[model samples]
Target: MSGNGWLRPKKSRQKLRKRGLDNPGDLTTISSRSSIKNGPGVSVDKDLPPLPPVAPLQAHRLKYKEAHSRIDTQRGENRDYTALIHALGLEDPFDDDESWPRRERDEEGERPPGEPVVASLPSHLWTQIAGYLNPKDAVCLALASRTLYARLGKAPFEALRRPENASHKLALLLTLDRYLPRHLLCFPCGKYHLRSQPGCEKLQPSDALVRNPVFVCPNARNMLRRAPRHRIAHGWSLPFSLVQLATRAARFGPHYGVDVDALARRWKGKSGDSEDGWSHSTRFLIHDGRLLMRVVSQCFAPPNLSPSGQRLLLFSRDDYFPYFSVCAHWRDGELTQVCKCALTHVPEELPRGPQSIEAKFKNSLLMGPRRPTAATAPTLCGFCQPMRRCPKCPTEYLIEIKLSEVRNHHHRGGVEFRHALVVTRWSDLGDGSAPSTSLEWAACNGDQAGAGYDSFSRLGKRAISGIFEAKISSDNTGIPGRRIMSMNPGNVKGGDDWY
Candidate 1:
């Protein structure tokens, strides 16, 4: 009917009549329909009617509601009723069905409901819990139960190895190991000495110094005689010096000396000795990779003494000068006197508050230079007179200490001697030159004698009022080949006798 043979108003009737089809008016003719029905294609059921039209709005809404209800019912069949009820904040409506879930009771292995869950946990779980605890608490827990002990195994120690637990670990190790002597060498005898207890069966002579390792040896009696110049055996005194060093180090750090109190408390229970006029306390610490110690001792005055007797005992004398001295023996066989401070009565005006005695002691001793002047200068007596050499030579690097009593006033008074000790590396002292007239030389020689006896006495009393201290530094150039012995007035063996 149209130019492309599609239906058009003008030619549609003519075209249909020519084709002789009853359905010509329709775009789909009878021949096309017949071909489609019989064509080689997928089969369809002509007998079934087309699906009904989409339901109306009300019917559609009703169908959706029914489907949703069915789904909810199915879900409820498998739901956790306890969780659901709790989430809904509802009480149980059915007595037969409890809302709280309970584990099926196992009569053979069941624990009491009130017991801690920790006790029933596996070993691995307990170890995990212990990993969170501090080493000390973990150790205590381990000791409480055999099962926990077995489970903990080395976990506590491993935990201590961690950086966070370093302080606790150090305290434990020090507490356990402190019984071992600090130094094994006997200064006088030059032999290893183990500490001996009251009933210790170690073979030794009756004259051996008992109850202490540094003093324990067959030749202990010869200590005073061997180094007669020094009042106590240099060997026996080394342990005390180490104690002084440790005490000083502990005052600054947390770990090193904390165990001292614990150890002291333990010792108190074991030693039932009565309180006496003389008291001694010692502590040790490790600082900057070196051992430190501190010792505090109280020396009470004799019961009674006349003025002359006091002068003889307390005044400057050749046989004994009351003071404390520290000497360092280098590896190169150089024994240098680092510090020599007089021991005098504590001043009445000085404050003794809650401050640590160790800190005060360290402060008192560290008042001097790091390097000893005697190391480079010519050795002289306290009077500035030339001195002699030591009788015995040191085989190894070591430290020597001396303690004695000195007068604090011209007139007779109650006498007391308190000493504090400290050790430090030589490098800590700066490169400052020694003064032309150092306190060591001035105090020894009384060069200030022009100031008069009263002034000198006051000066001497002030000098000896505080603690004695010493410092050691690395001498990379090594000690000089020429060895010079200390010329202390306390030296009774040889040297100028002026005091």
Candidate 2:
């Protein structure tokens, strides 16, 4: 195997020898044998196979053409197709009016050549085309110009006015300035007419304007447009006094005051010379903790009021101070006291009260637990002082409670502690009306709420202590009995008194 390398390259000679061994014959004989073996097969030398007979030009051309064909079937160019259509037109196609187009044609030998039939679009088609345009463009195209706007049909405008369609409102506001009557644009009505009417002396300075009507500016006209249409049967403009009060109050507070007369003059000029005036009320501010200036009790129409027409409003001391308390009017002057527990701590004891209520100091109001959800429920968590006034009781009180669960092995489940508070009412109640109530309690699971129900299930189980007392009711006094005493089991009750 090594010596063969001297003659031809060793691997090339080996491959050639392997091929010779496989052939073992002449190449020409191999083809002759293949032809004999395959029945009726043509030989390579046999007349080169008749060169494929020539095809007709038309057939070959059509076969070689691309698959797609574009046809331009517009007017004219094809007389035969047009003649066929004309023949069909001789009889009525749509209805029994065989003579309609044909009759007209018949009256005039034959219809003129090259005249196209104009088709009319259906109403729905026009609406669809108009809807795509913006409100302004739609109005311009469909309403502003009679020729174009009329054809659009009223549906588009109706669609625009819908409350959900802000664009419609904007469009109406924009267009109203151009067309609204003078009386409709002014606040008090009289000034607008005098200024806008022709031949009015107030408008005499612009004499040419009287001769020709000038359209109001778009910005001015737009201010008049509003919807959910209803007419104001009656309206009263604010008096100069009230307007001055509001403007001055806004500009000046306990900390600063503004020029009232100068402000009034500025306002007067804006209303114009008229008996019926216009006033704008902007802001009202509270100074320190009280209304700096009084407004008419009817400043805001009271939806509900006491028999005496007194309206009640409530506010929290926390709004002005960190600890629990509220500002109240006693006898005459305003006073502030520690009315309840500060909300910062949870599982808290209630506030303590005084024995003989001092002139300036009142008894401590109940500050129930800070946690709202508690391990147990108490039927009287919301009970108040049965008596209107007592040395040991605060007239008004608030209770806020939140519940949280604490871990314990004895109980299968944890207990939820309640946060509760009782504070004095912020507003005054005439005699027997029930006060509005609110609570700030929340229920939390042991894993998240912190403690469990068993924490205070048994007497003396709760380590947190707070003093509580109920008003000696008339029934208890008649029976010569002592007042009932209890504590908030869970801090569930939360929120203060309402007038």
Candidate 3:
């Protein structure tokens, strides 16, 4: 019951243990028969097919090689497999190695041939460069090479379509093609001409016409047919004197006096010669806050005027100042008669009696040179004196005229006489000095006609002592009137009047 209970005798075991107790190490080992029995379907060691005959070392290595080959084939098919491999915490084979070929070093340290030397730019950059060129230069460049031509053929035209390129296009046209067919289109008749000519050439006979050739279609037949009707619908054509007066007023306004020689020189450039026996005079004033300029001339004439048999000729083709009206008056002493030549309709009989003459003169003076029956005549004449007055305000007017004379040789071997007349009107701008609102007339016999008509016309030769007077008067209505008063020689001012 103590050390050895079941396997050895209880009392005798102590005595046997002293004798090694049946070999204690042997007692710890159990017999084969006492081992646990194998379960059903269990196999002996010899029945397990001898462990599949242990594959050869070379065969095992072959299996590993086949797996590596499949992995490499799949790596090319799946582009992202390498990245996936890296994501899975696998070491990348190419991480430390150079993906591209390393350039071989030379003593000069030059770049290798693996990469391109010059980089190619986009097409838009070349177009931007072309855009910076001038139109003419660009056109030339486009024509220089076929490649450039293909690219830039329409570039110049396309650029002109832009609003900012308008000036460029105009400059090109003016410098390169001033007489282009498109510029020769006629404004009034909407016709094109083969070449430019003076408008007068078409209207008058070659012997009676004198004008500078201009860059406009001058269809003489059309002008002659349309001129009279146009005048009737507008007003009498202004003489050279009045035209010069208006031009001066427009150039200098009311502050400066007109200088005839200076103006001629300015217009004619350095070609004008004062010794050519040309003369001019100008007078100016302010009326009802409007500026008025008058110019008179003698001997020299404008390009638009030429000599005819007994009367000075005017082409009456220019329509620059459509709103202006023209009047002509001639008097021999107290006797005055309105010239019927410039009028639309000339009366066969003259009015008799001093009162009737005065009334007719007044009517003609205010009505301008055009006949009263003319279609262009205004319902109320601008120069008419008003009948009523405005109590709160009053209007003031001024009138001035200058006479100039020049003596030149006529083809007949006698001294030729020339005269000019200029008139201007001004309106107050609430300032002390009025600015010019309109230039009435600046006319010269030298410019409009060869000389004074007195020697040529029967009526002019019958005149005794003549005077030309320009008067300004205001009525109670605060409206002012301008009239050619008496023709007495004493009433006419000399050329020095402008000073």
Better of 1 and 2 by TM-score: 1
- Candidate whose lDDT is highest: 1
The alpha-carbon lDDT assigned to residue 480 of candidate 1 equals 31
How do all the candidates rank in terms of lDDT, highest first? 1, 3, 2
In angstroms, how far off is 195's CA in candidate 3?
A: 1.5
Encode model 1's per-residue lDDT on 1-499: one tens digit a residue. 2466544323222121122244355352323223334444423235544322332443566687675553446555525566566755666444533454445433434546433554578788878887787797787677766767776787786776777765565445434333433323333343335533322222121233244432356764555634111111111232221232233224434322223232121011011244222233333233333333333333333323444543343322433432222222121121222222121221122233554656646755766312323332223234212121211211111122222244448523223232222111111110011111122212222234211222223322221111112221243333233232332324243333223
lDDT of each: 0.33, 0.28, 0.30
Q: How does each model score on TM-score?
A: 0.22, 0.18, 0.21
Off by over 4 Å in 2: 1-126, 134-137, 161-167, 178-499
Candidate 2 per-residue lDDT, tens place, 1-499, comes to: 9777788622211111111334456233223224335335332334334222222443354464432122234643444555567767777564455656776765686655321211155556666777787665665556644444445777666766665665344544434433432322222111122123221211111223224322232333243531111100012111212222223234333112222222211121021234112111211222222111111110111222332332111121223221222212121111111111212222433443433434213312333322443443222322332211111111222332233233336533223233332222211111110010100000011111222222223212211111111111333332222232222222323223222
* Residue-level lDDT tens digits of model 3 in 25-73: 5322222222224334333244323322223443465577675654546
Worst 10 residues of 1 by lDDT: 426-435
Q: Please report the TM-score between candidate 1 and the true structure.
A: 0.22
